[model samples]
Target chain A: MNNWYMLTLVGNDRTGIVAKVTRILQQNNCQLGEASMLRLGGNFTIMMMVNSELSSDDIITALQAISAELNLQVHLDEIEGRLHEHHIPNVLVTVIGADRGGIIAQVTEKLFNVGFDILNLDSDVAGTDERAIYIMRIEGQALDGIESIEAALQPLKADGIDISVQAIETLIA
Target chain B: MAIHPILTYPNQQLKQVSQPVDNFDHNLRAFIDELQETMHDGPGAVGIAAPQIGHAIRLVIVDVSNKKKIKHHGHLVLVNPEIVEWQGLAVGREGCLSVPDFTGNVVRAERIKLNAFDAYGEPLSFEMEGYEARALQHEIDHLDGLLFLDRLVSRRNDLFERKKR
Candidate 1:
């Protein structure tokens, strides 16, 4: 039986990182699964699920040459099951304002207290280094409905954070 | 008169362009009834297209009356529907019955002027805005074999995994 493993690689951003890493997996007969690969702050990060008959150590050994060639930090952990199971997101929350500390913490705390499970989140800084603007978009499911989620985030408005909550309804057409 | 099974992605039929409706006869009326029934059968489905049920015809049904505080044309059965004019642009999250596993943010026209035919082959023209316009645009796309995935605002970040209840 094939086993699932969470494989992660992080290093300085460079072209051909994906091509080289995926080629190694292909050569090793490792079946690729759901993956998220992106560049953040001059670093390329790859987090993916792989299914293979080989042991984790064997997979690591197979990747050793490419890892050293690209100077990438590679790590793998055996997982019991797949990690990309689908989840329907019910609410979309956007937070934008002057960059400051505790924005993520305070916003997440409000969501966590109400049993809201975040499915996807993306944050980025814009504007000049002298005046930076923090923008974050979070998609999640709110079991308690949008009104409650809105109420929970209402307090943040007082702090001059431009926040908006929208209900995400999927119309199948 | 029947609730047909929805054809999901990878069902190559969903990718083929649907033919324009030329005859609005007895068969067309019966098929329209089936489409309405199928739309009602889906979970929270406000619109549906003929191609979604494996029928490659230019036909769709939309009913946004159940939606609160939105102006809608009640029940709409558009035959050979086409958007003649559009205004503004907005990004909204959309999920499809054919692609149930994920939802994506798609850019759609905020307002639209549409021309279509009713079930009886009579010409109909109207204007729609807000959610109704978005729904119509999505249904019309099926006639051209375009899914929301094809129109995602940002492929890298707009697509999201949808949890099944």
Candidate 2:
């Protein structure tokens, strides 16, 4: 029987990180599952689901050599292997404005209050240091209908933030 | 007419380029009926292609009349369809009967004028815009062995997992 684990690795961004790590996993006879590997804030992070016959400790030990060599941090936790959980987003919300504190918090708070479940969110700061612009794109499900969700977020417009809510119609063609 | 099973992704047949329909006969009529039945059977299906039903032919059916508040040409049976002209580009999230697990944002023409033959082998030319145009492009893509997954705006950000209702 295979053991499932949620594995995470973080370290300074470098090339061949994925190649080295995956090669190690392959050598250990580890079967990889869903994984997201990306650079965030100059750090290369890998979050993946792994299935192996080895225990968590064994897996960690297997990765210990590369972890020490690359000065990377590796964490592993045994997890239930539930395949394929579907979560579809019904609405897309875009928020753009001058960089300010608590924009995400306030926007998320309103969504939480209205039972909106966010599936994915991406935010980035652009423009110059003196005039930074905060742009956030959110995909989520609005449990209470688009109108109510719009109303809940309408208050944020007063702060000079440009907010747009669009319904995602998934046409099966 | 019977509803045909839709061939999902990873089905090698869905990846092959479909052949053009040269002979429009009783058999073709029967197949079109089956395709229409299959489309109607699908949940929220607005268009369907021959390849989707494991028939590798350049035939597709599109109906946007059921969609509320959208200008549509009602039911369309496009045989050997080709886009003659198109204008504007817009991105919209699309799901497919073949790809049931996910939806993704795909850039499509906002307006398109296409020429195709009808079910009765009658030549037809029409223009479509907005949602209708998007649907037509998607269906036509199947003839060329392309899915919306192929035309995704961004593979990382545009693809979305679809929730089960």
Candidate 3:
């Protein structure tokens, strides 16, 4: 049995971000399980879940070396127990209003600050419509006693965005 | 007592129409036992149909009382149940034990008047509302060799592919 890990590395977009990144993984005997790498605003963002048979620190050290060479900000964490991924709550939040410069930054900053992980997201601002629609589903281990987290996101109301939260448990039914 | 493996889709048994029970005898009882046992053995299985277990009989056992949304439906063991009438339409995403890894939105009748025989071979007719009715119709569709994927209005953006675990 091997350890499973999730790594998120983001940095300036370059030609060899993948080759440099995965070379380290290969050296550490890590199998590339699942990964998605994309370019966003001139930066390369990678999200991957991998399986390994090595100690966590060994893998972290290997990635650290590559990160320094590539000038990438890399974060590695082990996928925890059931509470961390399996039983985590999932919520869908949608915002429909005039498209402005800070819509994504504002909405996502609030979500991240409140301890929500963007699991699967698809959003399009579209052409110059009077109102641009934004919809996203955030999945994460609910922050302990999420009532206050909910309160923090309430300020989005002033931006004229509609927000709703539904537990992923309900979706299983 | 016997517990049977539920036949997931891409298996022929899940798509075959089940035959109606012509008599209340040992075979019928045997089918009922196997259906219940199989459903209990499955994860989150609320119902099982004859075609799923290779019987090909129009029989299904449903007990959604263990589920969150339709526990109010109670425990039901139906043999050759028929939907005599239906009213209105309700839409909800549905999945099946036979199709282990996929779900789709399906529109079904909201309320239904049904008639069927109980496990004891006694005749029963009743009306079902809400989620209970939805679960009932889902199982019945299996009797006619229908899968929830067949009723989906359009292709889902994400069609989950199950890998051996």
Computed on alpha carbons, the lDDT of every model, listed in order, comes to: 0.88, 0.88, 0.70
How large an RMSD does model 2 have? Answer: 3.6
Which is the better candidate, 1 or 3, if ranked by lDDT?
1
Write candidate 1's Cα lDDT for A85-135 as tens digits: 678788888888999999999999999988899988888888879999998
Q: State which docking tier applies to candidate 3.
A: incorrect
Interface RMSD of each: 6.4, 6.1, 10.2
> How do the residues B1-165 of candidate 1 rate in per-residue lDDT, one tens digit apiece?
788999998888989999999999999999999999999898988899999999999998999889887789999999999999999877777889898767777888889999999999999998998789999999999989988888877734552432211
Task: Output the lDDT of residue A12, model 2.
Answer: 97
Docking quality tier of candidate 2? medium
Give the runs in model 3 whose Cα sits over 4 Å from its true position: A1-90, A109-117, A126-128, A135-153, A167-173, B68-71, B85-91, B153-165
Model no. 2, DockQ: 0.52
Candidate 1: C-alpha lDDT = 0.88
* Lowest summed lDDT window (length 10), candidate 2 chain B: B156-165
Q: Alpha-carbon error at A26 in model 1, in Å?
A: 1.8
lDDT of 1 at A39: 88
